[model samples]
Target: MATSVAKCFLLSRCSGIIRSVTLQGKLPPVCIRNRNLLSQCPSFSYGNRASDNPQDGHVNIPVDRLTVSYSRSSGPGGQHVNKVSTKAEVRFHVYTADWIPEDVRQKIILYNKNRINKAGELLVTSEQSRSQQRNMGDCIQKISDIIAKATEKPHEPSAEDIALRASRLEKRNKERLKQKKLHSAVKQTRRVYFD
Candidate 1:
């Protein structure tokens, strides 16, 4: 069973031709990259983060905190896309959401300045999938991805790391100066001396 799952994962990841793979009526956990196909497999689970800690690296907005509305999707699905309200639009007050960490809220505000409105609400939308449930999930995932990106911090350079970078920079400067001196000598030789 594990091998089958691994094979399915590898096939979907490696081959762009194979968007989804169904094995024995069960879909592997390869729906993350292509979230539009998430509706076809109800059993497949993406990262359903529930914790509030930003340091933990995942943030899941409580259902109550989110205000979701559905509209007709303009994506591929032919007649179904035109008739059904599959597009999901989610909005939440970033400043009022107590579940998110204060620091993370600040970061979200900083990173997503365009997404946030004057009322301090973060708006997210998804029309990638034809299914309403899948589209809603996609909207949530988009928000989570944004929050996760904001949560990441650049690693502080250690003493050795800093010293090594300084030495490499010094070496590059010396090489540049040597090249400059050689070029100046060549230009001097080209000049007609008026001795």
Candidate 2:
């Protein structure tokens, strides 16, 4: 279970892959909030936020904080693409979620500036799947995940951890230099007598 969360943390950075997870069928223990149950969870940027209110009105967002902007989503929609706004854009305001304090909002805005449009709205859209409901649900799930990330308390590596990382990197650098020197000598031996 802890390994799963670690995998999730590592995979979160990959582009265009939105992972939809349903917590309903499973027991409460598998919930996303419970992902940090490990004794010494490796310091990470996410999965550490304490809490959040899914409600947007309580915060502040256009069209009820979670406005579904319906644009005719391109690709595979075929004729339906021209007719319907099947693509639902789920908007979430970072400053509003109960878990995101003012300071954290600043960080979230900086971290996800690309996702947010010219306006203050953060857009998470679903067009990967065709079903309107599926797209919408997927969009909402992504929005929730983004909100979860926005509320996180940033992780700062401890001095000891930093030193350990530095030492490991130094060792790797020395090994690489030694291998390169040995390779150059092997190349020198292969030189033709015509040289």
Candidate 3:
């Protein structure tokens, strides 16, 4: 029975069919259609191991290290907005999160100094949606974007790039010198001999 269920899941995933699958009693029924949506479910089977693949350039935040909370959102949701908490705020300590790469953690801290509190937890909030689940997804996406941007390395100038820059600088200096000489010549003509 277990093998047959596993085969069914693999078939659905390959065929791009959205099916709600629950594993044992651990994970909730999650829509398993694509790899993109897999990250949204914190309890997904590959959620923790997804970050191990460095080739994808994505750093998946594990649920164990995250702190998520919801609060009442101030927006135009009529009576529903006042009664329910839809604003999602996701936070994780930058220094203490062992799942994040050490160098990337420092970069996240440097890039988001304003967002990180004194306790070193980076906070991201989203109140765009009336549904708490949507708001939480948005918050997670924002954090993922910040981490992705932080992971980018500075561009190293190649020999061709350096040569092109040098040529441009030389041309600019020559033009400036020519302009200065022209101005000096104009001022020289403006002078009159006292004799």
Candidate 4:
């Protein structure tokens, strides 16, 4: 029975028809079909993982190292918004994360001091999703993306690059002096006391 069910799922997914998917549950298969179709009809998928962090394990956020919680959102959705906790706050302690390098950790701290609390944790949030689970996923993905960027090493300018910059600066100074002389000549032309 399990094998048959798996086969059914595989066929349905290949054909891009979610209607045939069903588990041995009380919910009607038609209801599930409708729900699946509705979910797939959306333009965006919350499950899309784009993080480059190696420790994320292909899920963007390594859920084991992250904490995500929910709170009620204000405005719109009437009672549901005020009553249910749909806002998700994702937090990670950069100071204690074993996977992060010391330099990278300090960079994150210095760059994200506003988001980091006194305990030196990086916090990201998402209240845009109507569902709490989706919001949490989005927040986790965002934090993961940020940390991934931070994990990469910074590039340094070479001696040749520095000399090129100095040459550019010298040219710029010459241009500025020429511009100033021209400006002074124009100003002198407008002077009535010029002999």
Candidate 5:
């Protein structure tokens, strides 16, 4: 009987049909028609031994690390806005965030010192959206943008920049020399010869 039910379940699963079948007083788990479809899903499944290093262009700042809060937004809205808390505030502890690299952490701290509080928490707030979820998303996005900007290395002077600066300096020097020659020539002509 179990074998027959298993066969039916397999056949149904392959045929993209969902049918409930009882086996030993328990219904078999529903099987998906396309097993590979899960790979196309946006959510990713991480392994137990996943690397924490973000050097592979993958930032591992989990949502759990951020502290999220909501409050009533003070803006131009009707009674619904007054009653509902739509503002979202997200706080991230820069000093304690182990996921961020040490160098990047220092850069974030230095670059966003004004935003960071005494507790070393970086605070970001969003109240543009009327919905709490949307405000929360905006807050998270703002924080992520700040972190990205902080982690980015400053644009160093490239070869072209160096060349351009040198050329500008050379041009200024030439202009100054020409001005000086003109002034000297005028001064010589103005010199009264008391013969």
Candidate 6:
């Protein structure tokens, strides 16, 4: 009877029908699923997408440095809101990212100190739309805007600009003095003079 049972178990195992089988103190344990199978899968590639390309945007920050996550958005969407996780959150480690220039990184760090966390990661979130893809795009765009504004250089005053500013200042000063002289003349006339 034991021989027939063992034969049946072996046949089921070989045919991939039984996922796991435990015999009473006689046979070894058998597991059909291998946990290490996922390790053999190919790595993700961020290339080819327009959003991933740094050259297409105003800021040249690479997409690979960003870590994106999703959670359920908090708003009035009823049952659909409860089911779908559409909110997108993007995290970028400014100190560790190698693509950004040192000056730009410093500027970003200084300007966006409020957004940076204890881990030195800039966290940006978006839940404006019901779609996850739109939220992700909004998150990325927000980060790009922050970096762009931080790295922007102030417009230097040219020779013409300096001259124009000087002329305007002189004109204002002259007008102010002329107004003062007219007020003084009025005051002199109103003065109580005894001859």
The clash count of every prediction, one per candidate, is 0, 0, 0, 0, 0, 0
lDDT of 2 at 156: 98
For residues 1-195, write the lDDT of model 6, one tens digit per residue: 222222332333334442222111122223223323223311111112334343432333433456767788998999989999878787889898766667778888998899899999999998988876556546655765676566568899999999999999999999999999999999999999799
Best of the two (4, 6) by TM-score:
6
Q: Write the per-residue lDDT of candidate 1 for residues 17-83, one digit (tens) a residue.
A: 3332221122223323444433443221123243345565544444445666777778578889778
What TM-scores do the predictions have? 0.67, 0.49, 0.71, 0.58, 0.63, 0.59
Q: Candidate 3 has what TM-score?
A: 0.71
Model 1: clashing residue pairs?
A: none
Query: Lowest-scoring 10 consecutive residues by lDDT in candidate 3?
Result: 21-30
Q: What is the alpha-carbon lDDT for the whole of candidate 5?
A: 0.60
Model 3: clashing residue pairs? none
- List per-candidate RMSD values in Å: 11.3, 14.2, 9.2, 11.6, 14.9, 18.1
Candidate 3 lDDT by residue in tens digits, 1-195: 222222333333324342222111122222233444334444311222244553345454555566777788996989999998778777889999776678878889888999999998999998987876556556655776676677678999999999999999999999999999999999999999998
The CA lDDT of each predicted structure is 0.61, 0.51, 0.62, 0.55, 0.60, 0.60
Off by over 4 Å in 2: 1-63, 92-99, 155-160, 169-195
Model 6: per-residue Cα lDDT at residue 122: 93
RMSD of 6: 18.1
Candidates 2 and 5: which is better by lDDT? 5
Residue 128 lDDT in candidate 2: 65
Query: Which candidate tops TM-score?
Result: 3
Candidate 4 similarity to native, TM-score:
0.58
Candidate 3 displacement at residue 166 in angstroms: 1.3
The count of backbone overlaps in candidate 5 is: 0
Ranking by TM-score: 3, 1, 5, 6, 4, 2
Give the distance in Å from residue 158's predicted Cα in candidate 4 to where it truly belongs: 7.3
